[model samples]
Target: MADNNLWHETLHDHFGQYFAVDNVLYHEKTDHQDLIIFENAAFGRVMALDGVVQTTERDEFIYHEMMTHVPLMAHGQAKHVLIIGGGDGAMLREVSRHRTIETITMVEIDAGVVSFCRQYLPNHNAGAYDDPRFTLVIDDGVNFVNQTTQTFDVIISDCNRPYWSRREPVHLGLLRRLQTLPESRRHFCGPKRGLLSAAG
Candidate 1:
């Protein structure tokens, strides 16, 4: 609980949903964005990237599981999984739980987010970084999608919320490029490709 009447709130004006903080645990401005880990009496540990709430320890499982499982399940089977911009590794952790998954490649643009999540918001990652099936690539996700010869059964986007920035547009363009890949092994179906975003 807050010592005083003071409250640190993350207000999502569009959705009219706000998360309140009781205590601040960690706050840092990385090269990319401002990252904050705070304590909430109701939500446990809460993380915010660039002023938008990413996840709360109390409900992180729900978000991560849905982000990972729903897509993998819908795809029928996922052997090679590609994650883009999930520096917290929550999505990777959930993806690695499936033994059927042969390999997991996680591409996070910001190394700082990865290191910070490992150090302070460790609960989100849960040491999934050490999993044998997991591979970490610290580079621009757009570049990876555009240049990599590797293909995947599933792709996940777990980026920070858009704050009137170019990240989301660039990512969307990257997805478009992914959609245009060669028909044979690009997606499950040949000639037509399906695109799904975890934006909502």
Candidate 2:
């Protein structure tokens, strides 16, 4: 809730940031999390999940580009890509830019996030959801990482830190699973592969 049109984000007990809301576009308690989309004079539009700012229209490209492009570019010959938990679709939009990628599998736990973002954040996603190469799976990323037998030349873990009580961090779980995979199937994750890891 915004008091006097100011939305305060308490990043920590001692530090935070606030945005002046120009308009409240949408608000809902989704099946999986709390979601809000509001307009800010400076940010243009702001989307927050579970009371934390996720993406803003003004500067989303910086994050989406870096996360999607850096890894794919580094991989050089990446054809298949897996994205774990980028329901907002900004990451999808960026990844779709690579013409060489034949398939993009995105696993998102919350379908509501995809529904809302697709409707409200059109600029961010830019119809990437409708791309023929995209395949969206409404499932937990941890389960996908553990159970899937498919191989990807590049895998992008775009999940937020876990908010559920006592659940393992999403990326950590993926890392653990990756560690047990045979070296032949371990694509581009470790330091030896010249790719940055979330583990460190």
Candidate 3:
């Protein structure tokens, strides 16, 4: 419940954010988490995962751009990228902007989230799902990273908050693994909220 029948996202003891809900766009539960997408008067559309606000439609570019570009730019000659957990496809959309990058493989834990966003929050991903250079892998990011024999020039993790996902160790372990890539210049991009999660 929210003021004027709007939708609310509260992060218990820390903070609360609200959106004017034009309508409940989509709501469903996938194997890994509950997903919600709704039209907001201010943000256009919003997506939340397991009650935690993940990303809003309006400011997504800031996150996506920095997440995709900074690392790619820093690594200058990156040809391959491995994105972990960007189920919404926004990061994929940003990454596809670079024509020099030949391939992008995105690993997400929930296919339902990808399916849900593609249908309802259609513009959020901006058709990145169907890009020829993109590949989607539905699996746990940690497991994917641990098991994959292939290496990438850049690795981006577009996951939600660690506290919300109960996977802090997995995220940290992935970072530790990134440090050990022996033969390649590996660059990493992950959530900014990870700093807060790490502190806790």
Candidate 4:
């Protein structure tokens, strides 16, 4: 909540962080999540979903580049890439930088996240959304993986943590589905912290 000019992120009961808001750009409850975008002197623009910080303008390159480049570089001949739940467009931006990749498909559950982030967080996407190689699908990532007939050389999962209501981690479930792909080289990259495990 915005108290005075500061926005407090109570991600945990006992521990939280505060970012001084230079301006409150957008705040609303979308169909799938609560979204907020605000400007900060340090972070430039900050986006929070369900009261948890998701991305920032200032250092987005660090996370985006690492998650994108590391796996792509490792899978040297990757021509097709799939991304799950990167609604902010940062992942697309990084992935599109590769001239070798012929197709880039991103599946995001929330359309609203894409709408506002495109407007308020343009720097994150940087016109990657318009690239001819890109395709955006509004659907659940898990279901997309389970049903997709298409194949990808590299798959990146840039999603938020699993819902607290669910008993199992969503990444693990997605990983299981990824394994069913034909016996060939498949590279998978997920969130680096506690949320995901990399598989190749």
Best by TM-score: 2
True-structure lDDT of candidate 3: 0.74
lDDT string for model 1 (1-200, tens) is 12252334434445434556667888888888888888878888877776667778888898789888888888766688888888887898899889898998999888988998898778788889999989999888778877787767777877675544445555576667766877654752212333344554
Each model's lDDT comes to 0.74, 0.83, 0.74, 0.82
Worst 10 residues of 1 by lDDT: 188-197
**Cα-based lDDT at residue 117, candidate 3:** 83
RMSD of 3: 5.1
**lDDT tens readout by residue for model 2, 109-190:** 9999999999999998899999999999999987987777787777788886634436676777887778887877675443
* Residue-wise C-alpha lDDT for candidate 3, range 87-173, written one tens digit per residue: 888888888889998888999888898888888777767888888989898888878876776657777877776354455655577
Consecutive 10-residue window with the lowest summed lDDT within model 4: 191-200
The Cα error of candidate 2 at residue 171, in Å, is 1.1
Candidate 3 residues lying further than 4 Å off, grouped into runs, are 1-4, 12-14, 162-170, 179-200
Task: List the candidates ranked by lDDT, beginning with the highest.
Answer: 2, 4, 1, 3
Model 3: lDDT of residue 156 = 81
Please give the ranking of all candidate structures by TM-score, highest first, separated by commas.
2, 4, 3, 1
Question: Cα RMSD to native, each candidate?
Answer: 3.7, 3.1, 5.1, 4.7
TM-score of candidate 1 versus the correct structure, residues matched by position: 0.82
